[model samples]
Target: MHNAKPLPTYLVQRFQGWKATSYAENSAWYRRLASEGQHPRAMIISCCDSRVHVTSIFGADTGEFFIHRNIANLVPPYKPDGQQHGTSAAVEYAVTALKVAHVIVMGHSSCGGVKGCLDMCSGNAPQLEEKSSFVGRWMDILRPGYDRVVERKPDDMARALEKESVLVSLENLMTFPFVRAAVESQDLSIHGLWHDIGSGSLECYDPKANGYVVV
Candidate 1:
């Protein structure tokens, strides 16, 4: 309570504007949503980068996507030791409770988290090696990806690692028992995607081709 404060003036103004316009026009829709509750068909696990606008990228409306964002859009391997696992909790709720049909792991170009992982793995970013850094620990989920791409040419390393993040997360998502069960029963499907921020281009991992295909 001591740290709580009133909303900033600009945000308050923006909220007021939305309430007077979008909310006013969609009052019934909003009410219906409240009564019906959210039943999003797909769950999107994406990066925390603000530049990678998840909604606008897919032209999604409110309540259409159950989104869980983390550093580099990484999902840690299933570790159910009763720890406070934010990403895993979101996945569990989406698959088990919401019964989402699809889980998409999305990675974007020029991701700072990916670059940090690259630096950390290369022994260039010493600060991220410390135990106290939450970011460092979180980025550890991408270490396997780094190992896979460590030999790539310097010009292509960043993008390769970025795409690898999606692949790694997709692999790790299966480690969760609920997620695995859902996939096994054909109740859930998982996918991986990489996006070019500047070009607005998308690539989907094709299992048959065993590589990414432009989408």
Candidate 2:
């Protein structure tokens, strides 16, 4: 009974079975896309977590969204170094090359990254300094947000941290020159979205009200 094929093998076989026909339904569009290149309408900044898939959640096709997934859905400050800037590069491509009209920083409830940042900000919490993980360094993007809310309350920790991280990423998004230029020209817009997985509720930041409201 245990001699059965591995799960990945089964999944791959199932995927291969569907590829030609399932994808062929959109083969014509794929051909056009190959010819003209991608010109996505929106760029989505999201977490690398498996549960936070932007494309599937938004029901978008291949060219609908220019995607960037990072440890905490962080948007780092733009730098011209030769080092690998994964999220920054994706943002650059979306803003400069794809000319995407909108960017969404999608944060979810109970995010490990945000939680880590919250813990790091709380002096009484365990120190992450001992860990050599990249997540520790990447989560530094939300330090300012952590500082802004860490003194408030304990029960509000996770949600406050999540919302603060979203705002931090939105600010970081504007740090890129191309994004700033596009936004200034009114060709681009930025949004902060927080999804509560537990309640299946969606909260979007309202610029006018300066807070998140259920959508």
Candidate with maximal TM-score? 1
The RMSD of every model to the true structure, in order and in angstroms, is 1.1, 4.1
Residue lDDT tens for model 2, 20-84: 78677878888999999888899989887777877867789888888888777788877778999
Model 1: which residue pairs collide? none
Off by over 4 Å in 2: 1-7, 123-127
Q: What is candidate 2's CA lDDT for residue 83?
A: 97
Best by lDDT: 1
Summing lDDT over every window of 10 consecutive residues in candidate 1, give the lowest-scoring window.
147-156
